[model samples]
Target: MHRRTFLQSAAAVSGLLPLAARPSFAGLYQAAAVATGDLDAVRGDGRPVTLPASAIKDLAASLRGPVLLASSPGYETARRVLNPSIDRRPALIVQPTGTADVRRAVSFASAHGLLLAVKCGGHSFSGMSTCDKGMQIDLSNMRGVRVDPKARRAYVEGGTLLGLVDHEAAAHGMVTPLGTVSHTGVGGLTTGGGFGRLARKFGLAVDNVVGVDVVTADGSVRRGDPTENPDLYWGVRGGGGNFGIVTNFEFQLHPFSGTVTGGEVVFPIDRARDLLRVYAEWSQKAPDEVYVDFVMSQPPGGKGGIALLHVCYCGDNADRDLAVLRTLGTPMANTIKVQRYVDFQKSGDYTDARTMGEYMKSGFTTGISEKLISGIIDGFEPHPARSTGVFTQHSGGAIGRPPVGTCAFPHRHAQHALMAAVSWKVGDDGAPHMAWAKKYWATIEPLTSGFYINEVNDESRAVLNANYRENFPRMVAVKKQYDPTNLFRLNANVQPA
Candidate 1:
């Protein structure tokens, strides 16, 4: 079989395929290692837990979707997530096709004392979506997208990917605020406050969320919106998937021109110092409709890395804006042009290529100082791996304008959200790359105010606190109210008080 064909087939059975889309996996797993991790420990803080073989068999028989045991034919493939760094072995993998199926899985896991992990697009950076010797609720087959043009809303299944949302919304001349990656799970991203090229104008993916259909820890289906189950709604906005399994989402859509002007301009490393200094100045003065980011990464087939200034303008005066942007610095290449919004959306999604060991660390700051810029450039030049680099979201427009304490995300006042990401081959030692990223982040740590929950790699409880701030208390209250047992503790969890 052709190499690409093998990858496509592998991605399908592995439940890693993107929606409305293609795939990615290079040097992933040539051989699946059998897991021998302990299965009898308690998953949450409440009590000791255990799941017997007969109970697992009964749960398997009860599911409409296929139940794959560890030794089953497709079990190995079904268990892989997007990040190669995470290789967990769930005792039983249950694929759920609908909300009813999801409720059954949730109920079974809760009753049987089985640790539960949820998988949508399988894109969790921390691998919190799956666990060892536990039970996995796989929603890969539950993807469905419906757009109501007249109502200006789109109802997306929790299993849907950003690509499908973009495709459906574009057909109706509308768009939903989401992350840049086309294949990322819409459920995880939105539940944790998603943002993308359009976010500067539309706020966050959570901000556009109108309603949600969730299955709580008790197996009861509940709906949350501004007026109904308001506290639950607030918690879900940026609280990760701690409260329940979000089976469906209803998002308010924005009217779009269906066309955007954006692309990348690459400059040599020597010019990064000057380019970055100007980028800091431009980020503060740019219009809400103009979204751009400075990304440092190894140039394709090149020796050293280059700084790329990527621009996505969804507003008018593109010609004028492009002219002014070009003046930022001399470029080695420019790809900016008018294109369909969906096309532009697909341009920079690194996940479209292949899966690899990846780590992402984030920090949010209200301002970017010269020292921070220098630190970023220093981090870029000495990357330990080819894919190790850094970037920041110039997010002060719609993102910062959201009222404080409106939702679980507390970094709304931040003008920039910095991220240091590193990727490596499956078997390569990640220590050096991680160390480089840490060293890079250390130089700017004093300037950081908070962190983005979605991009976090540090699983420590203290980092989780920084993501929620004063809102952690309210989230704990809601978690206690709905998930008092902390059944949904797989994500960036807030232990029920």
Candidate 2:
């Protein structure tokens, strides 16, 4: 039986059917005390989970940056990550000023038997960057970007957001390919093989990685690149933060002049069949300079989904290239035009002003077959909520040519990736939204070849093994060498052998 079907059947048999059937409450966030477990929150190995007040004070004194406890001024804001679904309450939020501060935080967590999580842009979909009654080493204060125009390179601090990198790279008429959102942290994105508008032409963010300054589980500072500590370099390219806390990244930049002809064409649901058919045929042979995606979303105040064709062309003939995409179908709206790359990047950020609950599951596809297109259309029509939909991120071009086994990111040959996102208000019963996402995922999962570790929520050993595929053993070796005790078990963990 299909994996999702079996899981759903099992849940039904166990009285968990219709996930939205749980008792409902009306509130913006999870109950406050629920997040703050009783003073004793630590589990496993029977160690004392509670730390003395004096020890927290001492640790605060050691940090050059501020240490925020639950009572501090910015404690609430500091502890919150991007996803509202993750309402973890860490005991202390440590804002590290530099590599030294990061090292100190790691050492303190290890010595005191504290659960440690590393927070960069706080965009982790799995909420692995924060833990209950632990220390969240926030890199928000370390954002800094230095550009070497002559060498066509850039060095970005770990906590730096992709927006900052975009602005700085634009100053030099260059760019280091990153994700769609501007606020996403550079550390997590690059480490997980970042993909964005320029990726089809310039390659993934990891493909541009030249080096990294990292603080490992042992609190030792080290540098990894193509030469020195090559294995470490390989692991960090696609290995989530299981090995260490990356302090900074050196990237090779590409010239783009900060302008791209890109935008979206939206058509009513009636045109989906024709739109998807054309999109699948043309996108397969699209040039490296062109990036396009097929999206199905609920129109504002509308009953069903509208088909959207998103376009970005880096070549000179923007008008000529985009005109071909406009032929996808009769459109309800067409906004494709030449615009600043930075502005285009921000346009893709989540539209919700308040933090809303989010759940996502993504996988890679080798081609957009007719069955896949039909499944996508079927999945979006009866969306559980207006905030939920299925979309494809076109992937090819430079992404397909990376030297095999050069780095840990091995989904090089995938033609595109599909991500199913479900969103709802915090107070609502999340069962329906989660169930909707799972059912949609099940519809398309069989069409996919592999998964994108960054977009998935499943942490089961079986899922992790499948996500990494042939690269799993190598990642395990690296995990054993750097973190035998699983000090960084908060991510798509690659436990030591």
Count of steric clashes across candidates, in order: 3, 1
Which 10 consecutive residues of model 1 have the lowest summed lDDT? 23-32
Write model 1 residue lDDT over 96-152, tens digit each, in one string: 778988998899878866678888887777888878877788788789999999999
Each model's lDDT comes to: 0.76, 0.76
Writing each residue's lDDT as its tens digit, candidate 2 over 166-219 gives 999999899888988787888988888888888989999999999999899888
Measured by TM-score, how close is model 1 to the native structure? Answer: 0.89
Candidate 1: residue 218 Cα off by (Å): 0.6
Clashing pairs in 2: 19-431
For every candidate, C-alpha RMSD to the true structure in Å:
6.1, 7.9
